[model samples]
Target: MENQEVLQQILKELQSVNQRLDKLEAGQGELKDNQANIENKLDSVVEQTVDLKEFKTETNNKLDTVVEKIGAIEAVTKENLYDIAKLKLIK
Candidate 1:
């Protein structure tokens, strides 16, 4: 009867340990899933950052083009004014 009691106590202890292990396993699984989710979000952010950099470069290039066009127009206007002055003197 004493041996049976000891056996029953051992079984109870084993059951308790099994329950703890099950809870720990469940927690570890959840942690892994959360880590994956975080990594996916990070990847999306990185992609967006790259796109923003590309857009900034394109905008700067367009601004440079506009500045160049304005310079050319100014030069042409100056030449036209000089020609008009010369024509008026001839008249």
Candidate 2:
């Protein structure tokens, strides 16, 4: 009778261990799914960062061109002002 009780207790402990293992397996599956989702989000952020860098470079190039054109206009305006002043002095 004592041996039967021991066997029953062992069986109960084994079942409890099995339940714990099942819970751990379920948790591992959820962790894997969450990891996959996080990786996908990271990939999207990397792509957007690349796009933003390219846009910034293009904008900087456009700004540089505009500055160069403004410099040219200023030089021409100065030259025209000098000519107008000399013409007025001669008159």
Candidate 3:
């Protein structure tokens, strides 16, 4: 009878140990999932930074073209005004 009681106690202790190990395994799985999510977010941020740089370069080129056109218009207007003044003087 004593041997049977001892065996029962040992069985209970083994079951408790098994339950704790199961909880630890679940926690490890959650940690791995969190790590994967963080890496994905980092990749997205890097892609956005590259896109912004390209847009800035394109905008600068367009601005330069507009400035050149304005300069040309100013030169033409000055010549036309000078011609009109000469015509008035002759009259």
Candidate 4:
């Protein structure tokens, strides 16, 4: 009778241990899912930052080109005015 009681007690302890292990596994799964979501959001933020930097560089290049063209037009206009002044003096 004593041996039978000991065996039954051991079986009950094993069942309790198994139940705790199941709860721990469920908690671990939730942590993994949360980590995956955070990684995805971080990737999106990095991509947007790269796109913004490229747009700023392109706009600056276009502005530099426009300034160069305006300088050239001013130089030509000054040369034309000097030629006209000489013609008036001869007449």
Candidate 5:
């Protein structure tokens, strides 16, 4: 009778161990899935950052070109005004 009780205890212990191993496997799978999701999100964020930087550079270049054009226009306007004033004085 004692031997039978020992056998039952051993069986119960093995069942508990199997349950623990199953839970561990499930937990590992969940972790793997979460890690993959995090990596995908990280990649998307990195791409967006790169795009923003490129856009900023392009906008800055366009603004610089516009400023240069405005300076040239202002210079021409000044020269024209001077020429007109000199002509008026002579007349």
Candidate 6:
């Protein structure tokens, strides 16, 4: 009878250990899911950063072109004004 009681106690302990192991497995699954989500978000952010860099480079090129055109216009205007002044003086 004593041996029977000891066997019952051992069985109950084993059942408890099994339940704890099941809970740990469930927790590990959740952690893996969270890690996957974080990696996906990081990838999205990296893509956006690359896009922004490309846009900035394009904008800068456009601005430089506009500046060059403005400089050319100023040079032409100065030459026309100088020619007009010489004509008035000759008249």
lDDT of 1 by residue, 5-84 (tens): 99999999999999999999999999999999999999999999999999999999999999999999999999999999
Better of 4 and 6 by lDDT: 6
Candidate 2 Cα errors over 4 Å, as ranges: none
Q: Candidate 2: TM-score?
A: 0.96
Q: What is the C-alpha lDDT of each candidate?
A: 1.00, 1.00, 0.93, 0.94, 1.00, 1.00
Query: Model 3, which residues run further than 4 Å from truth?
Result: 1-18
Q: Candidate 4: lDDT over CA atoms?
A: 0.94
Off by over 4 Å in 4: 66-91
Off by over 4 Å in 1: 77-91
Tell me which of candidates 1 and 3 scores higher on lDDT: 1
| Candidate 3 accuracy as TM-score | 0.66
Best by TM-score: 2
lDDT of 3 at 12: 93
Per-model clash counts, in order, read: 0, 0, 0, 0, 0, 0
C-alpha RMSD of each candidate structure in angstroms: 2.5, 0.8, 3.0, 3.8, 1.6, 2.1
Question: What tens-digit string does per-residue lDDT give for candidate 5 at 58-82?
Answer: 9999999999999999999999999
Better of 3 and 4 by TM-score: 3
lDDT tens digits, residues 1-91, model 3?
A: 9999999999999999999999999999999999999999999999999999999999999999999999999999999899999999999
**Candidate 2's residue-wise lDDT over 1-91, tens digit each?**
9999999999999999999999999999999999999999999999999999999999999999999999999999999999999999999
Summarize candidate 6's per-residue lDDT along 29-63 as a digit string, tens digits: 99999999999999999999999999999999999
Better of 1 and 5 by TM-score: 5
Give the range of the ten consecutive residues with the poorest summed lDDT in model 1. Answer: 80-89
